[model samples]
Target: MTIRFPVLIALILALSAVGLTYEIAAGRVLAPFFGTSLLTWTTVIATVLGGFSLGSALGGIVAERPRAVALRNVRSALVATAVLMAVSPTLLGLLHSWGVRGTDGMMLSVILVFFPASVCVTLPSPLLAKLAIEARPGREGSSLGFVLAAGSVGAIFGAILAGFVTLPLIGSTATFAACGVAVLLCLPFVRGGQTGTPGTTIAAAVFVVFAGLAGTPACQYESGLSCLHVDRQGPEVRLVSDGTMQAAESTAPGEASDDGTVGLALSYTEWFWARMDRDLGPDPSVLFVGGGGYTLPTKLLASRPLAEAVAVEIDPLVTKVVRAHMPRAAEMIARTGFDAAEGDGAGRRLGIFHADGRVYLNETEQRFDAAVMDAFSSGSVPAHLVTREAFARLREIVEGPVYVNLLDRPDGPLARGVHAILRELYPHVEVVHGARTSTGRTNVLFAASRLPLAPLDSLPDRYSPARISDARAFTDDRGWVGHR
Candidate 1:
């Protein structure tokens, strides 16, 4: 029943790795329902950490038992942990189906699905360490140190594995299953542990495999950045990322707008272009900060064949999906590595740069006739992209009017904060609403330029200039827009 010290250390490392993998992968698993917002990440992280803390406490009590009894419990815990981790994807899906939502529901679901498995994976660590110490009595310090070091090292390895390798390569469902199988595989290494029946082992293995195969994937295409999928909304195909519909375009054959351009499916897009047409000159050069589905840029290329449209999208996979799935987006342009700033006299051209919008703005020398701030991470605009410093850089690059699209509560802090900063840089700043005043979230647009924005005033539901004295401007250091 004796296990070597090196083998014991390796087992602890593997167990800790599995535990952390589950923690990191939980965000991607919850994204389809929660939108991967700051709130979702915060809740997931806290709940997992809470479970680990509770498990360590439980492990301390169990470690006080006799060596044989403690080791026996470790084997049992690992098997149970494996079963729980394997079933987590299914549990989350069922919870979501039953209408789990909002901050409270998110917390409840994480507690129910992720918390217990975290506890089980961690509960054996102390037990294993206790056995290791008892086996080599005089080497207690080094044994304890090695056990702790193994857990820490394993955690680091697991994080890198999930973020860079497995989650992106195999997707979240497979990653979760792999974590379970890893925990189960640790059973044999526990010194003095009871040997479970072959039937039990086979049953656990089958359940893990079934769970891996049973769950519907969160997206058609998943990347480190998002869970991306294409959805059909009547005749239009929409690109959805992390549960938020980023862009939509009409798929109906021969469908065209009154302006003889490809029809835009989203109302907010229609309103944005209508206002920008007045601000932007003929044969205009446009810069899109975020190219979700590339709907607006495609419309521009179709309507104004002479116009130049450059889109800087962060995730290449998203643009890839848009080209393959969305209507007309496929025929628009090939992704060639071109300098987005190099504006040689080309009659009509489209450039798609896969980089952070803010970073692209900072590095590019190309100035544009107009710019659109449409970049977002899930439901929230990435805080970095909306900072005052980012806007100031954008202002320098874009000479004509700049249009921004965002979702926030009607006249919410984010809308007001963006308005405040834009006003500081531009002489004329206006807010246009895509929806009537409501308690819930809605699309809000901010138009800013050095010149008078007369067109924005004509748009329906113009937000009356509110006293924004209390609205805190978002800076690079502190960008706290209200959480959706």
Candidate 2:
């Protein structure tokens, strides 16, 4: 019996949509463990493409077989893909629970979760092309065009729907499961690709049962941004992102001391107190760009009682989490009433604005005595912020000094490029790194100001700049992405 070309076309479209969704979701799935960085994207993309290529080759070889044989292969491929897609997030979740992290772990997760499914998804495209050739003999060119166009349209729809709707609503784990179920629905819509024999059915059932038992992507909280990785190692409550601990609190029964400095566990958090020689204007206002776990700002509120502070963090969920769970932040907010709204305004002691740092800086009239910029992830710095224009904007808004904590090598392109950009506006710019600092991230800080240099040795073990041969300044138009 001949197949309806239109039915095959529609199934192919659906398959294409799911294929792209899997590819996109793979990156997000691996982000919490791997970090949503260039390297991570590159790995996911490369692995996905490799699977597609492998499937295409296998499909091309099988397309020479009889029509009945082709349909059997297609049937098996679709069912296998559905099973794997359902389990991908669960597999990643298991790895996460096992404390697997970093590049190697991420690659392993991608290979296990994504590669096989991608290969299965691509198997049908070549088979569909050959089947169409038999259905309509001389319409080879049109068959190719129609199939390719349908695939593209469906992929676009899948990406948009997954990103804007499914992810924001049901979350990553459920989204993966739903996409799998969607692919299964297409089997009925297109005729002839029926379920295989009894043993195959039992095997599929067994996989489903096992996958269901793997549990949802394990996390304290999850969003399109990042997973809220909460860990209780001992007495400490930790919030980690990308295996880099953002904040930790000492919470234990019958805790003896209640000093303000207990939460400043990382050197980077303590570095917020390290200031320049020049005085901030009277009644000083300070700005913190990113409030990861609210550790630094909490420390500042407790230590610098006289200085008024303003923290602008983009993620409201993160702000909410810190205020609710973190002990020191909650206690400090309660004591000062800083977290409360003061007549449609932020508190004087510590005003919090949930907004992008650059946008907040551009709009706010309040000139800060100091600004702490902790926005950039170690692997992914926003292109716009690293430019000369951004530095200029900071120069205009900040009166005293602007301190930037960067996770870059002293001689790396990022450090040198940012150094050149800082020199564009500030008369005096100094880069320092501490050998044994509180921050375990091992980041370098760039102190940019329009004044003379202060005594560097005041802070113990501060690593001075190594050397600069021929550094280049990053501008808004020129140097956003190419710095690395």
Per lDDT, the best of the predicted structures is: 1
For model 2, the superposed segments whose C-alpha errors exceed 4 Å read 1-6, 89-113, 129-146, 193-195, 209-213, 216-218, 233-235, 249-263, 276-282, 303-308, 331-351, 359-366, 378-380, 436-441, 456-470, 477-484
| Deviation from native of the Cα of residue 53 in model 2, angstroms | 3.6
Report lDDT per candidate: 0.81, 0.70
Poorest stretch of ten by lDDT in candidate 1: 460-469
The pairs that clash in candidate 2 are 266-438, 267-438, 267-439, 268-439, 433-463
Cα lDDT tens digits, model 2, 323-362, are: 7777777776566535422343443576777777778767
Local distance difference test, candidate 2: 0.70
C-alpha positional error of residue 416 in candidate 2 after TM-score superposition, expressed in Å: 2.3
Clashes of 2: 5
**TM-scores of all models?**
0.93, 0.82
lDDT of 2 at 229: 71
Cα TM-score of candidate 1: 0.93
